[model samples]
Target: MHSPSVSHRNAVDQILRYLKSAPGKGLTFSKNRDLEVVGYTNADWAGSVTVRRSTSGYFTFVGGFKPEKPMELHCDNKSAIDIAHNPVQHDRTKHVEVDRHFIKEKLEKKISRLLFVKSEDQLTDILTKAVCGRVFYDSLTKLGIGDIYAPT
Candidate 1:
């Protein structure tokens, strides 16, 4: 923003081109045999070398006909999960004071349960990191997105 460069312009152009090519691409929801709301969260710790800030994201699924239980939220970062469940504060977690307390309160009320998930299985990875072609497609499938025009 301070100094827009040629690369930044090119990146914007590339995104525009992609959007033009896939104008119809989007998510579609349908009735299924199971009905449950599951959430997945992931964080890329220190992903940005410039600022050493982490990137995190979460996605939720609703309705499939199956019986539902208390919502379960899967997080790949054990530290963040621990912070959400732990009532004590520490120097290292001072940066996330607000989020810590909010998530802790939710957990205490049994509104949701936090569970650990391996990085590879974390679907939110697609939003926070650059993944391979296969992985990207897998993430799309997990998110219930697919090429509707493709032959079955």
Candidate 2:
């Protein structure tokens, strides 16, 4: 089961609301906190029928504990992974020629790097599909969302 989340629906709106609603410029001085980044991503196996590309995205934030990029995406690619991964290219990859060339160039420039992640920990799936209600909530909750309460 998947639980509904306001954060997944409108990302831009979520960022704006977070910036506007957050208490202040974030506690840094006396809190003795260090800014850290946590990244996560997920991929759908051959999600696109038109090109047989996988839909995927990666995002980084301060682990919902500190202020950082808020909710900015580092990469959202449906057909670019093949370009990033050199070994994946074979006979079948010739179909998405243009995208392949472009993303390959980007990959060479250090613009992106591909990494493998397990399905059970693929947090991005919650946003990509209409999952069972409870399953969604459980995933998001485990990601330290909608449950963290900082005490004053």
Candidate 2: tens digits of C-alpha lDDT, residues 51-126:
5857666555464355443222233443444355664566667887667777676556654445445555566777
lDDT of each: 0.81, 0.56
Off by over 4 Å in 1: 1-12, 33-35, 50-52, 64-68
For all candidates, what are the clash counts?
8, 9
What are the per-residue Cα lDDT tens digits for candidate 1 across 1-152?
57877876996998799778766667888766775678998878889676696887889887764436667899888877878878779989888898888888878887778999998899999878889989988988888787756667
Give the Å shift of residue 67 in candidate 1: 10
TM-score of each: 0.78, 0.42
Assess the local accuracy of residue 27 in candidate 2 as a C-alpha lDDT between 0 and 100.
29
Candidate 2's displacement at residue 33, Å, is 7.5
| TM-score of model 2 (CA atoms) | 0.42
Q: When superposed on Cα atoms, how far off is each prediction in RMSD?
A: 3.4, 9.8
